[model samples]
Target: MTRIVFLDRDTLPTRPFCFDFPHDYAEYGLTAPDELAARIAGADIVICNKVVFDRAAFAAAPRLKLIALTATGYDNIDLPAAREAGVTVCNVRAYGNESVAEHALMMMLALMRNLPAYMRDVAAGVWQNAPFFCHFGAPVRELHGKTLTLFGRGNIGQTLAGYARAFGMTVLWGERKGAASVREGYTPFGQALAQADVVSLHCPLNAQTRHMIGEAELQMMKAGAVLINVGRGGLADEQAVLAALKYGQLGGAGFDVLGQEPPRNGNPLLARLPNLIVTPHNAWASAEALSRMTDMVEANVRAFVAGTPQNTV
Candidate 1:
């Protein structure tokens, strides 16, 4: 019988997993770094969400053949080590596009209309104490006729563009930064930043994209523009964003990820700014998306065990 170890069970719901073939499987609610080696001992396959699988972990589990990821982002895994060890790694994709895109739109609308500020005012009884029927302490804007610039042209970005157009907003795809010539379908990066009323990022994090939006880029953006980041947190400079918000260079911003998970080292973006909204890295955790992801993971596992792996990366 095949033995499989799920390193971090709490990454998903506590419901039972369905597999067509009979196998020996073990799951832990959470797995600490030191416990990784012992927990995955003697296992042929390992399933993980955010657990870091480094060289040491791979060395500790010589029997491991497949590493099935439950999430799209596999940066946490050491791909080079896995490849050297002849271990197959697979990831699920496009399962969270609809959920993440919808979240991006929601953040855009919330920032555009100053929803957070107004909601806080209402909660503080500022509305009830008002002498007039309506309280308009902050400026509110409409999404219609606004220009939205997207940093990526992937599935999530394309989905968000369609939603933006439905609300009468114009969409512009950003060209690669500092490219000598702009791509045919994309607008010049600097120009797009200057013209956008709302800017959304969907790009992946890598060497070129780390801190892609920093002080200089923030300064180039139009005053009072809203920025939304549904991509990796390291894509934007958190301190720069905080400065922009304080100086009114940016009207507001929304982030679903942070540079550091749990912010154990402390993050500047955690400050309670009236114009900033932060989510607990859950933009892709919607019920429908999670369900789809689970199904895809099962498919990946079954295919790999059948001698033909799919979605390998």
Candidate 2:
């Protein structure tokens, strides 16, 4: 028998299969930091989403053999400590790639089309009273023939590049910084930012990428260029992003993630100007994607139980 405890079940909105597994399984909807020790005392598998299994918690769970991350990003887990503790840490990859890529485009479209301002006009009865054929609150730009700069070339980045291609946009990928050598078509990060009409971020958050897009990077962007971040929130400095929008360094900016989830009420970016569109980090939570996420988790757990590991971090 195996005990599979899922901490922070609220983090994942998907419903999982209730059927019998080969090993005894137990599911806890959610677990808090304080509850980790007691909750994972005898568990064989601990599933989590955004819940930190810190060094203390790892030391507390002696029977734990696996830490199942519900999403692609595993920074929430301390991988080095897990490895040292002989605990396998794994996360699903590209399970929601297409869904998140489309969502990123949706945010970009809203910014380009000024959807929010127009929607406000309709709700305020101004549109109904308008005698003109159209009202111009913001300039709507054509995506065709525009240049799209990709910050990271992972699954999601390539997926978005494909969408840009469909829209008749030119794509340029950003190369790693501080490397003398460069990929054939990819340009240096700095040059890509300077040349792009629209820049999309799809990189993970690491020491090298933390605040990768800051005031200096924003300053290098062409006037009136749009910025999109569908990657980790820590990649961009929120204060700088808000400042850029306020001063028009960026004509428009769209984001699916923020530095903090359910961000503090006083987050600088939340109070920024009209050109920003913020969603509640739902880019990867579509129904179809949720199903795929759960299916992958089941597969990973089954494989681990069968003396194999799949979809690892």
User: Largest TM-score belongs to which candidate?
Assistant: 1
Model 2 lDDT per residue over 179-239, tens place: 5888888999899999988889988788899898899999999988888888888889999
Stretches of candidate 2 above 4 Å error?
Answer: 18-20
lDDT of 1 at 303: 97
Candidate 1: worst 10 consecutive residues by lDDT?
A: 13-22
Candidate 1: regions farther than 4 A off:
none
lDDT of each: 0.93, 0.84
* TM-score of model 1 vs. true structure: 0.97
lDDT of 1 by residue, 153-258 (tens): 9999999999999999999999878779998989998999999999999999988889989999999999999999999989999999999999999999999999
Q: What TM value does model 2 have?
A: 0.93
* lDDT score for candidate 2 against the true structure: 0.84
